[model samples]
Every structure is written in C-alpha cells, then in structure tokens.
Target: MKPINLAAYFLCGSNRESFCDRFPSYFLRIFRSKECPPNEEYLLCGSACPFNCSNPRGPVLCTDDICGEGCYCKSGYLRNDNGTCVTMDQCVGKDEVCGPNEEFLSCGSVCPLTCKQPEPLVCGLACGMGCFCKAGYVRDTANDKCVTPDQCPTEQCLNQNEVYDLCNGNCEPSCDDPEPICTKICKGGCVCAPGLLRNSAGECVSVDKCGNYTDGALSQYMNVINKILHL
Candidate 1:
C-alpha cells in the first residue's frame, strides 16, 4: 500500500493522542514508509488538497475543525455534494425570478406591476378628478382613450336620456324629441294650456273670450253702454 500524506494526517488530528488512538493504522503506515527509498512514489489520499494549511485557500478551507458554515457559492460558483466547490456560468436575467405573491409575470425586463397589490389600473385617458368612466364607457385599447357608450338616436327625444337639456339649459320634458316647431319664450308668459292667452288680469283665456278684460275695464264699458242704451 502507498503511504498517506502527513499533512492530511495532521489536519485530520492524527497528532492528538485521542485522535491517534482511533487512527493507529495511520501512524503505523506513516512510520513504516520512512524505511522506504527516499524517491519512492507514495500514493497520497488527501495531502494534495489545494486547501491544505501550507497552501491555504483563504477562509474557504475545510480542516477537521473548520467546516464551511453559512458559505454559499458565489454567483458563479457551484456547490458540490461533498462540500467541495466548482465554478459555473453567471445567471444573466431576472426572467425566472418571481415575487412572493406571484401576481405578475416578467416581461423579460423590469417588473411592470407591483406584485404586492397587483391590482389593474386604468391609465392614460381619464375623466375629471372626481369622475370615473361611467357605465357603458370603456377604455379604448387602440388609442388608450375613454369613450362613452354608443347611443341609438331614438328620434331626438328630449333630455337625451337625461344627458341633455333645452331652453337655456333648463330641463323640460320632451325637449329632445323631434317636434314640428322649435321652443319659444312668450312675451306675456304662458300656462300649461295651448292657445291660452293672458288677459288684463294676467289670467289665461282664449282671445275675445269673457275673461279678456279686467273688472275696472268691464265697469267702464258697462257705464258707456248704459248711457247709450238708456238702461
């Protein structure tokens, strides 16, 4: 059998009596190798370790008492099953990384939406500060515009689904409905009836009707008629 490297033995605690007692064969093998020729080629199991104390590889070396703790292979290093180290290609992009909530997918770039809340938001076209897109209004995908709902022109009915007004912005029934005649503000004003005219007392009546004159005007006319007819 080939002799073992003494440095490996020392690092394995062969120098200590308690350790040596457990590894007596290791000491005997090394002692017997002394009688061999000086140039004899001995097979060394672990003495050629690059991390030997004589050629220590910084703080990464693992001796009998020093095992790697909290040591992670660097970005380009691969950890071995036996706690040995090797090099690997560096990880390039964040495509595979994911947030805790996993709500958003990577676009092979920066994370777009905040994964914590991940709620969809309407950007670009917006209404007034207090206003949002009303019902039947949707965000136009082509231009990012917000468009109102499509309406069927039901013959220009008034108030336009309560969306429009008439006569100086005052809401009037049937204002949006198509009519033969347009609206007009009468000089003497008007009541609810058609062909209704305001008499001297501001009461509504038909032209040349009994309620056309005031009480005083009627009395004056009656006096004139009494004189004329001798009544």
Candidate 2:
C-alpha cells in the first residue's frame, strides 16, 4: 500500500461523505481559519456558542464541548442578532422611541425609583435594556406612568413651617447643631422650610422663637443669627 497523504486524503477523496463529517476536528480547524470581520477575530478552538446582546454572560450550560474554528466577537463586544459584533451601548435599536418622561437605555438600573420606593437604599449592578424614567422623575405605579416625585399621591405637609421635599437631607437646623454636615444621600419626606429651625419640641420655628425653650437654645439661636448678619 502507498504511503497515504493525510492532508490530501481529507481534502479530496473518492467518497460520498461530506468533508466536514468525514474529516477530524483538527482538519476542519485548519481549513476554517480565515480573515474575520471588523471587531471580530478568528478563533481556532473557540466556543461554538457565543455571547450575544440577549444573553450577555452566555449560556450557563453549553452541552456542546467540541471546540470549532470561527470568527468571534472581541473583548468588550457582543454579537447581535444580525451576526454583527458591536459594543454594549449599540445593542439597543436606534429607532426605538420611549414614552413621555421616559428614555431608552442600553443598560439601565434594575432598581428604578417608584412611588412605593422613591429612595432606594441599595441598587444592584445588574442592568437591562429598556425604557426607564428620565432624570428628576419616578414611576407612579398607581397609574403606571412616569412623573416627577412630587406628583406621587401622598399626604401634603400641613405645618406651615415644614414643606414637602422630594429629596430631603438628614441634616436640618435644630436646637443642637444649627449647622450640621449631612451626607449627599437623599430621603423623600417632609423637612423644615427655608429660614426655619426645628425647636426642642420637634416643631419648626423661627430663630427668635427657639429662645423660649432654654438659655442654651437662645444662645445658639443668637450665634446663628449673628453669623448670618456678619455682626
């Protein structure tokens, strides 16, 4: 028997079997190596199943263990339904239009502000593509519409000294610390209106009225007033 040439045997043979089915995995890899499209590179033993916009992290369980030669998306890029490699930001269709007070995002926060949970304590890093409420607005679950935080149906503050605030801070002028340093985090609730301070009785009052509580309160009130007057 003549010495058989493996390359020639796989390429052309007098057999009815197809080249892919008849040849070994290595042989298929050698022939499949070719130039890849933009934003993609040829892989000799890449995953047959690749990540896409719909499944970013790829399938949890890919049963096919056989590695194949093909063009795959490069790092930071994902294959779209049309087989084109693109960045995560380009995954969403440009023609998609969002409703009023809403905007489309390629990756938006999973924990968006709603009427029930206006100020979320913690939000996850996981995101998804969809239409979300625009800045300075929250979703009103009652009517399923996006609106300003103030638009949500809630009790209006009856106290003339206090005002309903969409984003209240922890620090408020009080009988103790007239100037309290507060964190940037916002809390949706009622707070003392401008030019008012919370007295010892937990009621918002003018600086002059705080003196009625105690001498210490009066001294603090005077100090704040003097500082404001630059006297």
Candidate 3:
C-alpha cells in the first residue's frame, strides 16, 4: 500500500483481459468433456436424473437445481446398469431373462395363459413387465414350464359314465331338460359322456333308457344301467 506497483497492475490488467476473451471457449470445453458413445446424445443441459432400464420413465420429480452438461441416452433407449444405452428389448436383467417358449416383455399382460386357464378371461387392466409364455403356448404350473394346451395332463374323472371337460357348460342334458341352451364359457369339470344323460337318481344313462324309469323301480335299475354304460 505504500507504493503502487505500476508494472504489476499493468500485467494483471492484461492477463484479466485475455482470460475474459477466452472465457466462453473455456466454459464450452469444460462442458464437452468427452465424445458421447453410441445411442447417446450430448446435451448442454442434461437431466441430473436420467432414464435407466430399471427406471425407464426416469424420476417423477427431479429437484436437482444444478445444471450440468453431459451425454445421455437418446429417445426410445435407456441406460442399463453397465451405463450403456440400449433399447427396451435389449435391457434384459438377470431376472428378466426368458427360457425356451418364453419371451421377455417390458409391458406384458398380467393374466398369461396357463394349462388351467388356457382361455383366461381379462382379469384386469393392469400390466406388468417380465417373462411370459409365447403364443400358442401355456404355462404348466405342475412343471412350471410352457407347453401347448394339448400337452396338458388329461384330467381323470371319478365316474365311469362321466368325462373330463376342459371347457364345460352348465346346460348338461338331463331327463328333465334333454335340450338346454348353453353359454359359451370355459367351466372346466366332469360331465356325462356323449350319448349319455343324467337321470333323476343322479346316474348317467342312454337317452332310450331315460323313458323306462318308473317311480318305484327307478333305484333298482340304476345298477343295471351303470354296468351297461361302463361297458
């Protein structure tokens, strides 16, 4: 403070002017640190929280106030855990991997086809992301494998006169209602075999034998009809 260094002041002013003239280029170089990789784009103001395979939609509300410049995944692509940008189909994880007859899905139906529910109804409107059975195939819970519907284990019925129905109807032919309208819906269960009808005694018999039943002797003829139907 005693004596001002005129030469030092002159040098300081000259250096400050040079720094100010190169400030824009220096700032640009700082932002562009490196070249962006494949499937990525350089942004002047990139999001602090970017989209990833686990979080495809990204953060719902980004509260970061600091603006930064960097390379980010482009549209229709997301960064994986390895920090590599890829499409949804290529963003498979350890759990998202699928086996034969199965495929990975980013948004698949929740109600996938199964042996028990080959013709499953729309369970809900909600969807999920995971591996699911492919078309023309159904999941077999018994073996936890995907197979054709016909490959499902055949259901064995207890009664000899009854047969297993994959898609049964409520309108079973009976002595009272020989011909009833049935709705087309899958109701899997056991039903009387073709050419057989349920009688009043809860026994399956031929159509011709239904008219021969008498009020008092109906129970006695049940054993005979059972033997004939089983044969």
Highest TM-score: give the candidate number: 3
Q: Per-residue CA lDDT of candidate 3, range 1-231, in tens?
A: 212234334534467666535574553443343356888776777778776777653566876575567777776677888989888777766344465698756566777888777787766887654567889999987987889999988788898799877776456777666665676656667779987888888788886678865443443445556788699
- lDDT string for model 1 (1-231, tens) is 323455546655545656557776665555544543432212223222222111112233445443322223322233333444333221222222212222111111121222111223445443111112233443333443335323211123332122222121221212111112433421111131333333445344443353423355444543554587695
Off by over 4 Å in 3: 1-96, 169-171, 212-231
In model 1, where do residues sit more than 4 Å from their true spots?
1-128, 132-192, 210-231
Model 2 scores worst on lDDT over the 10 consecutive residues at 1-10
TM-score against truth, every candidate:
0.14, 0.46, 0.50
Residue 176 error, candidate 1, Å: 30
RMSD of every candidate to native, in Å, equals 30.6, 11.0, 15.5
In model 3, what lDDT does residue 196 have?
Answer: 84
